[model samples]
Target: MLAIDETAAARAMIQISRVAKTYRTTDGEIPSLRPIDLSIADGEFVVVVGPSGCGKTTLLRMIAGLMPPSEGEIRVGDRIVTSPHSDVGIVFQSALLLPWRTVLANVMMPVEVKGLPREIYQPRAEALLKMAGLGGFETKHPWQLSGGMQQRVAICRALVHDPKILLMDEPFGALDAMTRERMNAELQRIQRETKKTALLITHSIPEAVFLADRIVVLSERPGAIAAIYTVDLPRPRQLDVLGMPEFVRLTTTIRAHFNAQLD
Candidate 1:
């Protein structure tokens, strides 16, 4: 059964209670996720990892309120997530920055959409870009930057609106291996500074092990929580942790689950 801590649920910023989904097709009903019960406390960083087709993205979309669960409910800050709310920010695999807009303008897009005063959010946006190491490139267009730089711009855009929760779906998946490592470090620093409650989904065991305060591993399709691990490794983690015994042990344990599937 899925684990639920009553105390954590009481203080959760995001709560998933018996939430599940099934897609109805002409042929039959196709289940995506099994009933899931999880809670993310305010300012906590949680990462979900699963095999291909395990509905990791489906789960994130449900929490974002982009889609609804066929069963149960999702609550954010004690409010039910029946529809997409401004309290959340999302980042996807690709940077998805508009080519025509300058980096600054792209980051300002959310403010524009909500018809908020640019004068007020301008300073905030600039601050976020600078934090992401995109300060000097504000005036440059998306096409002018390298892939990793563009993704940094995307991170800035996601945070510019000052959302309380960040939902990232493989935000670094498109970068080269070396660049992905660097972006992972950058993301950890940003998360620590912002203290925004975050949920990230990735296929990489190392990524999940490195960044998560707690890691949720999902079973293969018709996804359910296979295990949830609390990372005891030290905070402000660095690449050197990859060599540490605890790091290797955790990653190896998580990896073995997928390896078991092929047996």
Candidate 2:
């Protein structure tokens, strides 16, 4: 059994300590992520940003328990995450919905997989879809929706399980710039209303600066923490907040950290 570390319980809802990942292939052992230490408080929105292949997705997958770390451990709340848990929800770049299934059906897939009664989870799924602005579209198929609408369904699906932590890997990366910005605002609104802890992995620094309470920057290859910047701007942030002087300053600081890693 994994022992619960009291230090990990300090302010964090999730604690990652000295975690590393390596893949063994015919050629050799390739290190994807170096040992890393990170703590994310309850209800905090943390965005991990870096260049492609910097192991941002690897780190998020490790936290989601989709993959195990080669070393160290990951803890969520009081329990160690050795496998996938109901308390965690994950959304990837693609919506990946079932074409044959209706939006409501896709949202309720997890509840069904968990063997919960349909009657119980059905209402919850409906509510999540409504909250995500797809209330009337629940009967539509993924093929019937726009890119942004499909991603909205994806977000709703992740939350339908009512997970305490949401792990998103470039959820908005496939959308156009305008749609991405709209989804970003929508995400903030949902996070504010639900107060769920979220860890998002993205390559866009501006997106990271716009959405996160704190931005964690990582270096290339055997990824390591390069820097962490706290976004001090006030909450209930508007889309206009992106234009503020403070927002520019913070993004500039984060960009500098990324550039430094490249040097």
Candidate 3:
């Protein structure tokens, strides 16, 4: 049996029980994820890392209630996730901001979708943008912002609705190395301040170690939980943490898993 951290399970805000996924195609059934279980504590930061086809995104989508699992169930704070609920916000690789909309407008998109009162959420959107360091760019369009800035806008948009949980899928994959590192720092800070439970999917080991409270590893296709490691490092971690013995050790251990798979 896959063991879950007892402390986390006891107070889990997100409980994924035996969740699995298989796609039915004209050719045949394609197994995307094997039976998997995980418990994410309220306000925790969990990062999932694995090979390209390891079903990491599939797990994320299921949690977001974007798709149903082939088997098992997922719950958020005692409520079963049958569909996309208001308590969750999602960020993707692309910013996906509307070209016609200004930065502030893009951030308010969730409010529009949910039919929330503009008077109530408009200020919240502006506040989130300001928190993301785009305070003066509220009137600017997506085309005018740098890649990192656009992603920051995306993050602000995801939070404007005040979701309790945040789900991100390879959010920094499109950035150059330096910018990606900086975004990692920014994301960590934002999560800290907002206190939202987060689950981010990424292929970068260093990124995973830097951002996660716990890191979950998945196997290749028909992905199963290969391992889960508690970060055990201090919070408000800086980039220099990458050079720390514990950080290097954790990243090396995670990297070794993939290397063994290739062997």
Candidate 4:
């Protein structure tokens, strides 16, 4: 087993050291993120929360190796990430499921694309579907499911390959309030069971406080890590905890950071 220092291990399952991102535009050069030094530990759930144009997604993309940083380095485990790898999985705001594929087919798509044997991954796919509460919906198409259900399938798809790290960008942002809350609860359960290192990007302070072991707040455009607050809340968190004074206190504190950035 990988022994990690719970206290200091925020050193990162994935590390972003002095990273920056720049884009060449028609006008000139545009910088999205500044030098950001951050670490997400093994099996740790970290949320990056910031305003609309805070470059939160840009940071996530860099970590996933979907895009390279203009400067600095990103390391996953001991390897530097320069390109997307099978060990990392990503889910965006949209479920992005194939319309024609059944839930099972979508979940198994990663394995198919990798040219892995179906027999080797079929059982794993089935178990993931069941875990995501889609056991009976395996044969159903993406259009046949509700928004929340579609997102659930998207998550199972991300986890189907047994990735050591999962990068999610506002996966529940599109759902209704109640459904989003339910999905939040389901996500906590899934994280507890899978223990995958996760990095979530969201604009919701409460969501960040509820789902993250640590919340990294970023400043506006050309984003930089403004603050990092450890949740320190007990695990397997009950949704009811959201109503507790402690939860409310933490939420307010995070909100204050965002509010300060605006000023």
Q: List the residue pairs that clash in candidate 4.
A: 12-40, 13-40
The candidate 1 region of ten consecutive residues with least summed lDDT is 1-10
lDDT of each residue in 1-46, candidate 2, tens digit only: 1335455467689989899999889999999999999999999999
Off by over 4 Å in 2: 1-8
The collision pairs in model 3 are none
- For model 1 the local lDDT of residue 114 reads 91
Per-candidate Cα lDDT values, in order, are 0.92, 0.90, 0.94, 0.89
Give the residue spans of candidate 1 off by over 4 A: 1-6
Error of 1 at 87 (Å): 1.5
The whole-model C-alpha lDDT of candidate 1 against the native structure comes to 0.92
Give per-residue CA lDDT, model 1, range 95-171, as digits (tens).
99999999999999999999989999999999999899888888999999999999888888888889999999999
- What is the Cα root-mean-square deviation between model 3 and the actual structure? 2.1
Candidate 4 lDDT, 119-164, residue by residue in tens? 9798999998899888899899999999999999999989988899
Residue 252, candidate 1: Cα error in Å is 0.4
How do the predictions measure up, each by TM-score?
0.97, 0.95, 0.96, 0.95
Off by over 4 Å in 4: 1-11
Model 2 weakest lDDT span, ten residues long: 1-10
Ranking by TM-score: 1, 3, 2, 4
lDDT of 4 at 65: 87
